[model samples]
Target chain A: MLTGMTAKEVAKMVKNKEDLFILDVRNQSDYQDWKIEGEKVSSINVPYFDLLDGVEGVLKQLPTDNKLLVVCAKEGSSKFVAEQLVEAGLQDVSYLEGGMKSWSEHLEQVLVYADEQLKVYQYLRMGKGCLSYMVISGEEALVVDPSRFTDVYMEAAKQEGAKITHIVDSHLHADHISGGKTLADQTGAAYYMMKSEGAVFDFMPFEEHDRIRFAHVDLRVLAVKTPGHTPGSVSFFVNDKLLFSGDTIFVGGLGRPDLGGKVQEWAKDLYDTVYEKIAAMADDVIVLPGHYANLDQEVNAAGYVGAELGAIRAGNELMNQQDKQAFVDQVVANAQTETPPNFEEIIAINRGVDVASPERQQELEIGPNRCALHHTH
Target chain B: MTSNKFLDAKGLACPMPIVRTKKAMNEMEANQVLEIHVTDKGFKNDLTAWTKSTGNELVKAEEEGDVLKFWIKKGE
Candidate 1:
């Protein structure tokens, strides 16, 4: 009998580095563009059209001993194919529930920090590498850089016996759609963002309020009006304990400044932000970033994607450039020119300048994140 | 712009449009055009890639509100 597996269960298998085999049934180009990836995930692509008649042709390529997963764009085809595999005497055959679309939107929530005063949780978007966060204190919670799944945050807030009172978008995201506005609307939370991001929606600008104090959050701006890749990029310094670095800094490298076509100016501003604004913080402050590239390399033993400010500074040679010119030059030279797939549409929808159906949004966001590039490599 | 045959694949799900198109093309002569209309949004990319890999020519592809139209010329 064939069974269906949720994305969350598959995420656990990937987390444990379990040996698995994935037979992706989407078109060749679709599979080549973006698909599930992990250190232990071994997969192959055979277009769904080829298997409509039967599954006998591809059986030779299947590994009988490995955990077999059939995947497609939606759950329909995978289930259809998995049934055929079962009839062909394959054991332990299963399909991904809701298919790649569900996998794309699946978030693995991991607790990052907790104390008597506050508790923090990080939601890692397993497929897209996008990271969102929530901080609970007293009877209120503050969500930072939420993804499109508003219910996940709202539901999580309820489970913690707290209400979502504040929502912040660290910057105008280019890779994925921001759930800040939707989440705020659903929970009656005060939405915050930079006014210069050109959002048409009502939001509390970070410029007017230097400090957003509620329950226990003394959220202060470390850097606003960045004028880097995105003009309104702001870093949230939470209670002077954790730094929500946004896209400005990553565990592997700095956020590439070439997205806005003014690499020189952006790179210079990034230099100032790094050397002037962020460097003042002590080494022990944990840096929670907006996105990650390699999970194994970026995630710490604590099961979250963050690092100590001191370790990030001491480890990366790019952070030690004393001369502004050399640092700017290096940032410009090392920047990745490839922009995120369908960024224009995603940005327009995020800015509230346009709207799309849920299907359209998922179609637009079906690819890997290209926002962070290593300044070193 | 002109096709010798028409294949209406509207309302079909994954693999159906491509599956029908392949069958229709097999019965066509070399250089004959096969016009297909599909509702699956993903078929846009699939048709483009399918034509390229199968050595067929995609004469034109356009969207009409909810439907995607394609013209594939069978290759020898």
Candidate 2:
């Protein structure tokens, strides 16, 4: 009988860098757009339609030495293919339980840092390449850039014997839906974002609150006034130790300032934020971001998706620039044409301008992450 | 505007929709039009890829409410 592997298990395999083979049965374009990816992970695609009659044509392509998993848009097709593979005498065949849909929603919690005052947990939404975090102190938790899974944060807080007291969005997120409002309401925690993002909901703006101090933690807020990735992109600087660099600075390069359709103007804001705003920050400060394009490349040995400010500055050209026009020109030229899927709707949802059913939200959030010009970015 | 054959894969999932479409396409005479109704939203992308790969012609595809509709012409 073929076994079913949960998304969490697959994430663990990828995290452990285990040798794994994937037989992806989703359509070519879908697979091209997104799929389970990792350093140790290798894959082949034979759309389930080709295997509808039987798994014979792909039998020769299946790997034998290590674990093999079949994946599809949903569990149905993968299971259908895997059952046949098992029936045909393949020893190690498993299907992703809820398929890519579930993979898209899985959150792998990894503790990035711990000190006497607080412990920071980075929630890697591995399938989506979106990262959120929770800072836990004495019976209090502060969440940053939460995904739609509000319960996960709530549960994590409960397990830590902490109540979520503060929630902050680094900026107006276009790549994925922000759980800022929903999570705040669910936990009765105060939510903070830039008012310039044009959110319909009323909340404490980052502009008003220079620092959000609760329990033993104090987080400094840096709100970019110009049209950044959006008009009001903000980065949270925590105790000068960790920088929650919204979409402004990523591990590889920088955020796509072109999402607002003002490539040059927004790129200039990104340049200023990099030079004027983040210039004084020390090298050792760990830089955590909202989205990651490539996990293996961005994730450190610490098993968290982040990098040191010095490493990012040393590696990316965008981060090292001194001239404003040159930086803007380079960013504009390197702009990515593909935006995240259904971003307009997602922005509306984030701003509380529009609402979506849970099912509709899931549908809108599917496909690959296109937040960066390149994963190289 | 009209199809010679209609397939109701409305409640079906992946592989099933494409499976039935392939079977129906095989049964049809050359150039015959088959209109398919599937509730799976991902079917829109899958149907296009399936037709292109199998040498069938996709005449039209659109979404109506929660269901996805497609018209395909059997390859000669």
Q: All models: lDDT?
A: 0.86, 0.87
Model 1 TM-score, 2 decimals: 0.95
Off by over 4 Å in 2: A227-232, A373-377
lDDT of 1 at A212: 84
Clashes of each: 0, 1
True contacts kept of 2: 0.81
lDDT of candidate 2 over A1-377, digit per residue (tens): 68999999999999999988999999999999888889999999989888888988899998877799999998999999999999999998899999999999999999999999989999999888899999998999999999999999999999999999999988888878899999888889999988778889988887688699988898998866753345536788987899998787889878776467777777777777888879889999999988888888889999998999999989876677558887777777888788889999998999999999999999999988888537424
List DockQ for all candidates.
0.63, 0.80
* lDDT (C-alpha) at residue A279 in model 2: 84
lDDT of 1 at A292: 86
Chain B TM-score (model 2 vs. true structure): 0.94
Cα misplacement distance, residue A204 of candidate 2 (Å): 1.3
Q: At residue A297, what lDDT does model 2 achieve? A: 85
Q: Please provide, for model 1 over B8-64, each residue's C-alpha lDDT reduced to its tens digit, 9 standing for 90 to 100.
A: 999998777888999999999999999999999888887887788789999998899
Displacement of residue A219 (Cα, Å) in model 1 is 1.5
State how far residue A75 of model 2 sits from its true place (Å).
0.8
